[model samples]
Target: MLKFVKNHMESIEGVATYPMISLLIFFVFFALLFWWVFTASKAYIKEVSELPLENDNNQPKEDLL
Candidate 1:
């Protein structure tokens, strides 16, 4: 099996830089994914944190007729 694979690879034409190119492509893809999730989560956390302050500052008062 190993010999067959080696022979097949040797017969292939111009596949030398595939590993490096694939690595770079995957790196950028994951980096963008990480940045997107990080920013989105940060915004959500900030919004959630500010809710308490808003509620405290605007507590509803009972209306007397």
Candidate 2:
């Protein structure tokens, strides 16, 4: 299976650049994500973190017959 894939990949033109471009894109995306996480507001993060524990009383009460 490995040999088959390797042989097929070698047949494609410009296949080498594809891996490089994909790697660059992956690196850039994670870098931006890390920057955003570090620079995000503490209050916003606190609110988001507490979202699951806060009850807004939005749920409808179920009627028991």
Candidate 3:
């Protein structure tokens, strides 16, 4: 199976660039994610973290009429 995949990949033009492009995309995505996590507001993070623990009963009721 490995040999079959390797044979097919070798036939494609510019296949050498594929791995580099994939690596660049992976690195950029994680870097942006790390930056967002660090730059996000503490209050916003706390609110999001406690969302599941908050009670639905505390929400103001809306009128159906």
TM-scores for all candidates: the values are 0.51, 0.76, 0.76
Compose the digit string of candidate 1's lDDT tens values, residues 1-65: 99999899878887667888999999999999998877787778787776755545454333221
RMSD in Å for all candidates? 9.1, 4.9, 5.4
Error of 1 at 54 (Å): 24
For candidate 2, write residues 1-63 as lDDT tens digits.
999999999999999999899999999999999999999999999878867754567332342
Most lDDT-accurate candidate: 3
Order the candidates by lDDT, highest first — what do you get?
3, 2, 1
Pull out the clashing pairs in model 2: none
The superposed Cα distance between candidate 2 and the true structure at residue 51, in angstroms, equals 0.4
Query: What TM-score would candidate 3 get against the native?
Result: 0.76
Which should have the higher TM-score, number 1 or number 2?
Answer: 2
